[model samples]
Target: MICDQLNDGYDLVEPQAPAMLESLRAFGYNIQTAIADLIDNSISAGAKNVWLLFYWDGSESYVSIMDDGKGMTEEELVNAMRLGSRNPLDEREPNDLGRFGLGLKTASFSQCRRLTVCTKTVNQNSVTRRWDLDYVSQTREWRLLRSAALNSEDRLSCLDKVQSGTVVLWEGMDRLVGETKTDDSKTHKRFLEIIEDVENHLAMVFHRFLGRKNNLQIWINDRLVKPWDPFLTNEKATQWLPEENLYFREDKVVIQPYVLPHHSKVDQLTYEQAAGANGWNAQQGFYVYRNQRMLVAGDWLGLGLQRDEHCKLARIQVDLPNSMDSDWSIDVKKSRARPPAFLREDFKRIAKLTRGRATDIYRYRGKVIARKSSASYLFTWLKKVKHGKVFYVINPDHPLVKEALNIPIEYREVIKALLRLIEETVPVQQIWLDSAESLDKQSQPFEGEPSREMIEVMSQVYKALIKSGLSIIEARKRLTTMEPFQYFEELVNRLGE
Candidate 1:
């Protein structure tokens, strides 16, 4: 009775239908993510196949997404169409992607004005419901129409072909093709490009689902989408690190770290394709998946890590159940994820290890030499730090540098001055930018040069070692352990005594 009296004292300050519905348009959904949100509904509904149609008809252009999922009836369709139909706190089925429940309304309103859903279920007749924004704004009432607008019925006809399925139609696409004419070739081209963007986005986000044979198939204008695996699992040189599991409140977070193969290890075609939509550098880091559906692709999750060129090969996979959505701070758009405070340190540790291995592969892969024997892969330039600032200096201990420094005292000063000038003028900025932009295309030392060029230099170093009281066998053995010569063992061994 006291609670009832307290409730009765409150004023009825319901939100205005016009303002409330219009506000949903700012949920930050582009065409790619909007369509993806609807597909999440299809997948949760147990859809096997989903088809997207991008029709161009000037101002009458419309897009429709039809799925062969177990369809909802009149009552269920009405509730699903309502904004915030289900509480976000409610526990959903293991495979269901129905969090927030505003994905349908917010995602659709972000792109179009008319949202119609026509669905059919077993033992139930086909039912249709439409939400026209114009009508709601005009009447200042929440009025969901009984069906799609006239002449737009043909778009919903796809639902008729399936025994139990649903078709979502998006008309009045002012946000996408505003006043675009059917004969305008430019608009047609832009429309086609948007379709391609949507295809690419879907290919990545739903790659795990699309990879399985019996899982799901998504089609855009009848063209099947192929999954773009980030890790290049099929490549022989790709490294698959051991997976670790972290438990949080009985929720298991599985982390699988991967070091993608260097561009030189794979074929040209494979190398280019594996660069992905944002190139190799931007595609590094953790790929967070919720219930086998990828959420954030290639992000550090605010772990204070930079996507440097050397770490481009490092890609980690994080698998989380939908139950941990709140823990990860998954946004409505599902593009961002922040690890909980308790798990941030664990994530940072794993990132450091993965990036370390990637840096080795990006440089000379020194660890590989260490594993083989006591030999070390020597670098020509040593990166130095002075007063917390970075600078590059020529490696003094390098065989070639040692040979030059071992010259007669009369010319030694001139050689030292020349080396200092060259070292000081090393084009660090240009080289860094060049490597950053085209690291994969950057050539290795003497990559395609003739063997004789390398042999001439190796002979100088070989002669110096012999002059220092080392035998020819010992000299050649030392040369075999040196880089650029380690790659040419036969040539190193052939040096005459």
Candidate 2:
């Protein structure tokens, strides 16, 4: 594998500039992520305030990100605009939010055909550099434009207000606004929507930075953006599980699980706000952060776990040092990460525990579950783990299950088969998607508007308990402890009154 043996025989070949630059635009950056990549550079440059201005001129619309960071020199600005400004293998500063070093060019080109950067130092005048895809295509060379495309002066004016900072302008936005005319209202609305998405993304990704008092401030068209805290840690009802630190090659990964309060516990607005960008179900999994910057949000990291309504409140925070980026397979877009094989077992264990706690809160209607249940309290369904896989089994000891089993021998098989089918064919993935789409629409057990049906069922269960040789008081108490009945404590108290 040594390079010394083949160095003399190697041939010098370089990639074609025009083709290479065009291909760089295919790195799969959406408007939100592309904007985030540019913000990372602003943060790395030690910016106190970052402003994103969206100018809508229909087909002529442009977007610019200006930051009061330590602006680079003219030579450094040109290098920063290069495709590969820094080696990925080289050790980066602890605070540097970049790797592969192509975020500026690649992210810009992914959204627009033209990219321009104007920077200034405290002691020097401003300087500008640009990359125009049209110029590159026409000349078929690695050409860096000395002047920006349209509205360059107005775009650079943002930096003039600050002593030293950098401003990134995106013009020729073919991928975004396209060829729509200035009077196109539909396209203008879509453009504003994109700006809103960028604002939300920046609020979440740079939340840790924005939360700090006097650290960093982000503005969208001059309006301040508030940080979106995923864990709702400030809420009094939020359950902060024990934090665990796992090791991978001498580096530490901090894992902290949080269980949000049930809807009944929190007000409707607070509960809705805590759902995050993708809603409660999609935002239930692990949130991976690197150097306080979020990389992967609400993902299971390929672990064998499905997002379920019963566990939607469980969100885990995973903090990884930048040094372990390669081990975690951090992508250039910084939107995905895969846990190492050795760490998957640990993640699975933590996930199981958190999911169990969340289910308890969900099923018990915001009440804390007891570690040990009373013998008289019956469970209709039980979870069984076999061969490291989970399966739900109907409890034969339950009054209804036992009564159903007392039917004719031939009917018993049919009942058992039906229960098995229901357990095995649980619509896990569908439930996850439905919960994400409208969590409030997914009703809790017997939570519908008609209370008569639930009352009748509860009365029937009470009668069954009474037939099993339980005293009236004992039956009533047991009914209060049962699954869905536990939530309807007042109804259980008035049963048979």
Candidate 3:
């Protein structure tokens, strides 16, 4: 359908080298994600071990990531350094984590002005290539340096010990350590803190790889990094919901929801650790992964669900294949993902189920504790329906209700009327909205009261039953069956003592 005249008139206008390269640096990658991009290449090259070393010298600081992966040759290294070397539309290998083939260059330039890559293949000579932004700016052309900057030979020596591997060196860290002196302890401390941040990010993003047995290893500054499993699947009390497979076209997305146990079910230290890096409240939602590499963590994905406290323990794992990258809208930085329109409804349905289970766990933690005992269940308020209208009725058989009924006949009618009025004026809709807004603000039955208050009430019911000619054993048994008191088995045990 091309017109001959228009096709012949079109002129060739290439992007200015300096301007495009500078613009490529603004891909919104922080220190952690930039390093992760390099690691992705190592993994694709079949590296089992990856080591990250950060040497702090303030503005002179340098960071290098070395991996024992299949290294590229001299010519391959040059092409890898080229921008847009691989097309996003090209079909990649099954294990390839890259899409646009721009991660190594863009990720490096985002953090530093100097990027040097040293690599060697099996029984082959080592080759090194450098991309200096300053030099490129001066020349205004596509240029690759033959050697790394002076004094970096020692740092690059570590790669020589291995048979075949690649080492990515980042220097002239303008964004990270600009113009700070080596003696500045404050800046030095801040640089060290960034290392900690990077460590945490890797632990989360590559948790699947780190947790695999003999799969992959990542170390930061000689310390082994452990994977942080969001599901807490190892705990005995963690609820593993049924796994589901959702399909769209030819691709399949696997989803598994987990409802973590309440704090009472686990030790204090485990509970604190389970809160994750962002704490429990912020860490609740779907975790989207592509090729076992996490892209979106602790996100609701605009699924019309708020991060409510009651559902904080809910975490769902979603697995996506790399082939669906464009469909999911995965960004180059690998920090964001959006489900395609066709799959949003399915995601919402699964989210609702998981949140329901988590809310049940949060609200009924006491009920779970009570299940261990053989005591009969009791509730002070009974739900009743009459003439198709639903409402609550106070249980007349409850110990407190019986005691109030035993008052002088003159007051019994007034007491009954007051209970009826309370039922009629129940703020159902208001309470529902308030609970949705802030579940933490809702109080549990007899919450925060002194233990003595519960004990006193238990004692009153125990004595009343005993006066009616019941033995001590029968009185204690009756107390165990009483409403509210059933939730406090220990206080019920202390009765009549």
Candidate scoring better on TM-score of 2 and 3: 3
Model 2 clash pairs? Answer: none
TM-score of each: 0.77, 0.75, 0.76
Q: After superposing candidate 3, which stretches have Cα over 4 Å from the reference?
A: 1-8, 366-497
Candidate 1 wrongly placed segments (more than 4 Å): 1-7, 365-497
Best by lDDT: 1
Give a tens-digit lDDT track for model 3, residues 431-468: 64455455557676666653777777778778777877
After superposition on all CA atoms, how large is the RMSD of candidate 2?
13.2
lDDT string, candidate 1, 1-497, tens digits: 68977889666798999999999999999999999999999999899999999998877899999999999989999998999899999998888886898999999999999999999887678899999999999999989999789998888888778888899999999998888789988888889999999999999999999999999999999999999898888776777765778999889999989888887689999988888889988999999998888888898989999999999999999999989889888888877788999999888878887887699785566444553653465666876655534567888877778788887998999988888898899886676445544446867666765467777888998887787777888777777666667777777788873
* Candidates arranged by lDDT, highest first: 1, 3, 2
State the lDDT of candidate 2 residue by residue for 309-357, as single tens digits.
8999999999998888788998888898899988998888778778877
Scored against the true structure, residue 104 in model 2 reaches a CA lDDT of 91
Predict model 1's lDDT versus the native: 0.86
- Candidate 2 lDDT (Cα, whole model)? 0.84
Q: What is residue 141's positional error in candidate 3, in angstroms?
A: 0.6
* lDDT, candidate 2, at 38: 89
Q: Point out the worst 10-residue segment of candidate 2 by lDDT.
A: 366-375
* Backbone clashes in model 1, listed as residue pairs: none
